[model samples]
Target: MSRKAYSFVRGFSAQPARDLCVDRHYLLCASTGALRLAAADRVWLLPPARAALIEAGHPVRVDLPQPATTASVLFDTAFTTPPPAPLTVFDLSPLARALLAECGQWGASEEPLTAYAETLFAALAAVTWRLAEQPSPVVLPAGRSPLLRHALRFTGERLGGEIRFEEVAAEVGLAPRSLARRFATETGMTWRATLRRMRVLRAIEELSAADTPVTTIAHRVGYTSLSAFNAAFQELTGRTPTEYRASFRP
Candidate 1:
């Protein structure tokens, strides 16, 4: 019988211009930028301090619309234990971050990689075990009503651009006002509120390890003015963008 191998890699930067398809039980830690993973049924948002696990042989499209740096590990199903959930999003602990950094340094050392991978799995499993004490993970369900789905998809595509009611409504075949009402009914937030939340989530990902200026991050996430972005960021996160970045940085 052919034996399967454990694999680890660093610095994965999958561009949004092309679809990145993978065929392994993959786990990834993104240091910067919002990482979107689209599997057959669900889409996961991978932000800093959060990680994603994808099952083996599952088709997934990994999208990072902006530049991002990440470390990933792949396990061939023939050799590794799989997560109970098909796809899982879990909080990254400080120890988990340290483990990932050490794993990155291990490079192509197969024995060390295997050791680290097994330890990583144990840590992740421990986290899952503690879910009874922790809050539920941040995740969004994919299926939605036809009009609602189209509008949300349009909003996601235009995250850094202006998301207007007129355009989204037209694309979804609903009047702008009716669409707004339905969106709130379905998602429990108004269109503008939802857009702001999405923008802030994207901003948090960019703020994770950016060497760029805050104004640039603001512009990159679609705020026209620095002040507006600051207020919005603070409102959503209870800390300004600068403060959030500082907390993450050593």
Candidate 2:
């Protein structure tokens, strides 16, 4: 019989510009770099400490701002049920990491999986589905409307510096109050909350992709005080900037 699951490692020099969909369930995590995954409703930053599980046929845009190596596994539907969410970004457990490390040696083969390999894959899938129940807070919601999209784009561009709701509203041609309502309506987050999330998301990308110092990264993402940055980062990610960056070490 054909293999029910396989794993592969891929490297990207630049971010892919298009969305991708696949027929098999996918577990994607960065082994030596970082990943940014954007789905319909949410965007995720995956460093070595986190993973994104995508259900078969779900379209997602993957961004690798830095040259990165990704170790991922693909499972045939016959081997496991669909995940609870269409796409779930969650913390990667030690067991899941160990399983992926072992399975990754196969390197995307079509040959039949041995019984031991089958069992290992099954265990990994089980752990994945369970972990999906607890999604990570390190995600930002995406916006759909044109005005909201414009506002989001502006915020992303300005994340490295201070951003105010009034500035964004004026830039997007909406009143401050009106823009706040739009943000809550479309993304289900207040303008302040969204900005905080956006800043931390950018910090995660930097933390994962470079050797920049924590204080520098904190300021780069618009925080004036290092203590304030640590509080916000830990509130969203449960890890300080230094600790989070250390996770990427081999």
Candidate 3:
């Protein structure tokens, strides 16, 4: 309908790098699988139980490693106030999910919305803003400096193996202490914490596949001990791997 608010749905089965920037506020959720969104200074792991609110005109890179069904709504700037952050990933409650599903019925129409449709969108917008108050921890901060960026890249590429701060620093041509300082300054997280966050986020990507075993996912993310993997995952996400996966189950 009119640009006040409109719904869009899509299914993605393969990995594709999509760089997106639109003039309308984007509320995106994956009803079936997971989505990885990378902005300039942050990365968010959006699971089925979560949704990300992207401010209008903010560019982001989207990645879908597994098959996923996405239900998204774009709101005209005049229709609602902006969220506090440029991008926010938050837990999606049942009511919010229902609202999104119902709104999907008005998918990307060119005509004006009926009065009833307008009311429905207004309610959905209220619920979305309220739920966005408590942001989720399934996000990682990105570094700005080239050295720090290189270090992050190195750590990400070697997530399946043991990653040491010293090793990363050496690869990036910096001392361990200096690199640690850079990480804290640029990413607002200590090197060890950043590494742990990376592993956990990567594990989430693997967990998105329904057929993958938890033990396999743990090892794939560089955890030699399943117990440690479970504890780390729970500490960051507040849910065990199995519990998180169960959220996607019908």
Candidate 4:
């Protein structure tokens, strides 16, 4: 059997993007900018000192404010023990952060680094599961409009498929003009802008997973062609799919 790659990225945030799951699981820490995850009727807000646990096959939407820094780890599906729930925000303990920092500086030493990283990974998973068991306050946007909520749910369900404004408007029983206005008013973003973020979030999951090819992943996530996918991925991630995969090697 082929071994799955584990991905790690640590850098300053540039802009907001969307990510859809491929096969890998993601653990993310954002020093600034908020991260949002929406699954069906559920939408979550991850603030500082919190990390988001994104499961495979779930479509997540992310938004980063002006400037932010983030550290993320992508591991194979097999590596993740089942969480009590699909998504949870956990406190990134001091030890978890320190270990992640050490892993960042481990360089090319596979021996010691691998062992230490595994330990850290275990601790991270435990913390996330523990947090999931405990109820944390959930914050949903105040006065969220029905149209915006409908759009978000529609996006999450169809992350791997195509989406059009007209289709979304029809689903929500609104005209295109009316839907656009409602989206902006409730979500603080245009329908197109929200769709773009949703697409990027789906792409992140595809890029992080092991079995999917970049071209296929791109098409699956709504890019018409490979070039478009590459451009979008680079714009959001600062690295190509191949380069990102290499960072995750175990």
Candidate 5:
């Protein structure tokens, strides 16, 4: 499997932290249950109807729960250019999901398997194009407010350190009340909510690397205590830090 130019994995089980040193891009689509894919800078929360695109040689660790079904394919870079980013979590419609499953089921000698891989790759490329033309299913708001923009730049620069809201407002020549109101009005989320989201997203990226412990991640992301970070993480993503990091463990 390690030396093969193409591979397909379909099963009803879980996978521990592992790395494949192949020059083939990997596409994973989940049909039922849930799986977590952990990479260097991102932890993908993959559920039904979601797909993850990973670049060739970019290591990922997979963890799955019981009653789970997923189809993954490894193909040459000729199929599609490397993803523009390190990680992209996009919606996968049912029809495309079935197509992916069908692609995963092809079994034959290496001679045929390699050719069949091209057909599968083409289909996936076409499917990806169609999905891109449609609106993104997952929309995290990034509003345009000059003051808010300045405030964001100011806040973002000091993510792991202290974030004094009043000081931020004062520097920008706006009252704290006005800053909160304008931020909520423009971003559709309160200042605190935005801050939490930013921290959590950054935390997710850091967690995938396995370089940091859960306790340090909480503090690194500005959580005063581990318990507080756990509650906030679960409240937003339905998973705790330990559980999320477990998906990346060997």
Candidate 6:
């Protein structure tokens, strides 16, 4: 297995645009603007004080939503353990950022730089683990009714299985019609839209661990047809399943 690790900084240019084809998992922290990951029309926003854990082989179109400075560290599977996923958004601590900066300056020197880089890597790993141990803060959109919380929580917990709007409504003690209206009003997305997000997140998690067949992943996330699963995955990730897997391999 080929193992490589390095650290660097990125300053966004005017009209920034780059689609990175990563061969290893990458940890990135932004100092300004926002980092957006697009899969078709869907976008995940990353702002400063946060880090984005992009999985190996995931073809991501990245752009600075505004002028920004980003510091990043890349590590292959040999150098770092694969993170638990849908891609992780971690709250970056000041100490962690400073350590990363110092590591970047070391530039592969053999003695002191090697020692410092090792220590920095250890700290980074510890910080990432601590963040993962914390619970996710669910952010409900304004105008969303309290009733929708139960349905959302249920979907999140059962993302590995098939979900239907009727089932979600029944679980919440509402008719499908009423539930649909309320869900749209409160969440600003239909139940189907929410399900898609959940499924995509699940797929990302699986992809990070190992190269499982896309069909298996699609089924695990509740798609009955492989073609449909591929379509959905590409529509959201802007890359085919094979392309995503290839990015992580050495």
lDDT for each residue of candidate 4 in 1-250, tens digit (9 for 90 to 100): 3223233555545465566665666767655444555555445655445577777666776655334456676655776676666666655666656655654543323343356566666666666556666533333332276667776778667867777889988998889998888876776667766666556656644444345777787778788878877776666546676665544332
User: Candidate 6 vs. truth: CA RMSD?
Assistant: 15.7
Per-residue lDDT for 1-250 in model 5, tens only? Answer: 3323343656565546455444676666655555556555334556555677667787776655334566676666765666655445666765666667666565423554456656665777568546645432222344476777778767767778888899889878999999988887877778778777767756765665445888898888898888888887777666786665554322
Q: Positional deviation of 223 in candidate 5, in angstroms?
A: 1.2
Note the residue pairs that clash in candidate 2. Answer: none
Worst 10-residue lDDT window, candidate 1: 129-138
Q: Note the clash tally of each candidate.
A: 0, 0, 1, 9, 0, 4
Evaluated against the true structure, the overall lDDT of model 5 is 0.64
Q: Best candidate per TM-score, number?
A: 2
Residues 1-250 of candidate 6: C-alpha lDDT, one tens digit per residue: 2225667777885356578768777787766555655433234555455677776777766755356678887776666666675355555566766666666764433333356566677677657646644422211222344577777777767777766778888898999999888877766788887777667656654654455888889888888888887887677656676775554331
What ranges in model 4 sit over 4 Å off? Answer: 1-7, 10-17, 105-113, 141-250
| Order of models, best TM-score first | 2, 3, 1, 5, 6, 4
What are the clashing pairs of model 3? 1-109
Worst 10 residues of 2 by lDDT: 101-110
Q: What is the C-alpha lDDT of each candidate?
A: 0.65, 0.85, 0.86, 0.61, 0.64, 0.64
lDDT (0-100) at residue 182 of candidate 4?
A: 81
- Using TM-score as the measure, name the better of candidate 5 and candidate 6: 5
Worst 10 residues of 4 by lDDT: 134-143
Candidate 4 global CA lDDT score: 0.61
User: Top model by lDDT, which number?
Assistant: 3
